[model samples]
Target: MSETTWPWGAGTATGIGSLPGTDVAEAQRIVLGELPDLPHLPELPDRGPGADLIGRTGGLLVELPVELYAARWRIAPRPGKDLRRARDLMERDLDQLAEQAEEYAGPVKVQAAGPFTLAASLELPIGGRLLRDPGAVRDLAGSLGEGLRGHVAAVDRRLPHATVLLQLDEPSLPAVLAGRVPTESGFGTHRAVESEVARALLHGVIEAAGVPTVVHCCAADVPLELIRTAGAVGVALDLALVTDLDPLGEAIDAGLGLLAGAAPALPPPAGRAPTSAQVADRVRRVWDQLGFSRRRLAEQVVVTPACGLAGADPAYVRAVLAACRDAGRRLAEE
Candidate 1:
């Protein structure tokens, strides 16, 4: 919680969430091997149905239940096979992680759909997205807060030696703020959520987690100041999409963590990943341009892939993750 106590220690690296395959055991092995300092539980969205971000997170809710209907996720009557499969897959993943990293003792990250994104994606039983109803959105946030607390506690209990780090994935946050989410009819757009409301919703989940939390969005229009003010300890975004550094500077000044997405999520045309020096150079240039002290770069920043590794092949995913770890080591040498 303090500026001096970093969960991943100094100049470490981590992923944005999600891996390349369905083999949960292999995912854990690669993650722990490549990013030892901040290995995260791999999200296997490829499992389909309940394994995707929305269903997986919805399955974690305490009372609220959701189901797939006509290709949309709506509030459900009860936990169906789809959602049951999701929770089962999650349990299996944890079981595999516990077996693989039985002796691991470090910061372990876990991710889920953030409250704003969940509301935008989940359909209400009354025939509309939850984002269209303020009360429904508030209620969903409360539910997610309670669910996340339990999820984090479960991870902590499973890996007692490791510190659990929560990463809330809100890739649709920019659209949520821009009023770009389409209505159920797919014709009209929904109203933009006010900044105050957005901050409160995010704050609720973060507070409920009761641990160091990071907000990750790979979009170009990330709300750096909003998440920082909402109490997120770290902000993860695609470095290639960012240009202005004023807000990032302020965040660093305030002791906020920066998960710099410097490596390519997809394979490069050159047919090989960037070297450690090359990857760290991008972060160094950004730090220099931001007028930050070089000495603090390792303390306040973390190297990561530009986004989730779900699109890449298994080999490419491992290379990108290894590149991130090497980049962090290079940064530490400075």
Candidate 2:
């Protein structure tokens, strides 16, 4: 298979809802069977709340368990080293990746919570408040960076032939920096004076990950400059929520790969999957709105759902994944 200069592919996550313990190999088979050239591993979400997609992946933060525990984000000390357990879990995941490597013949992605989200999710033990403490935030970021580096190396060792893409999920970034994340009492939010503080910490992780990075955010107001400044090669965003395209257009023109959310994350209308023509039309519409030529579309974009399918109905989830693959094909042919 010839490698395109940009990432022209599909987003990953298990069918929005799937039965528990859906074999990783089966999920990989399902994706590759439908879209052979660009399949990514699926994230099974039935693993319980703590085992939810982000939580499962974000377990990398286990490296900061003591710090996190002190902050009240996690329960008091257990009997073991949380970081070691996390590494073991990650290794197991990498082993699964190795098993599915034959199916995913293109870029292989592994996503985890970004630094900002971790900071927000972790509570400080002192006041049982989130690690919104500026100094603590920095500590969390460094720990995340170090943990991510170890993760990348593990994946490389396990799946040596694949081009690894580390995806940083940062849904809390804008809210964290803008003070939109409300306090426990819900009366107000804490604002970070230097948004750059968070940005720089995230940037450090991206740099340290030692692989091409994509910062994914399903929320509004994705900070284009911050993402680019972090040295990310791609940005995955929910297309339905894009109100402003100017900055995105500039970024696309600047050679960033876009995992365009062309397909809806929810199930399509009824038992019907969205047809190729409909998806092609949506892609065309978005590009036309940007005033970009059709010929350049393939080089700049990959089709995906607006976000992970963790909350959708199971049948609909499968349909959406199939729809996204078909949509990418239809758009490419168009």
lDDT of each: 0.88, 0.65
Model 2: per-residue Cα lDDT over 89-190, one tens digit each = 445556776776733446666778887777677666555445457787777777778877887777677766666777788888888767788776778787
Measured with C-alpha atoms, the lDDT of residue 210 in candidate 2 is 79
Give the alpha carbon lDDT tens digit for every residue of 45-151 in model 1. Answer: 88787888898898888788888988778888787877787789889988898888877898899999999899999998888898999998988989889999999
Residue 297's lDDT in candidate 1: 88
Angstrom error at residue 53, model 1: 0.9
TM-score per candidate: 0.97, 0.85
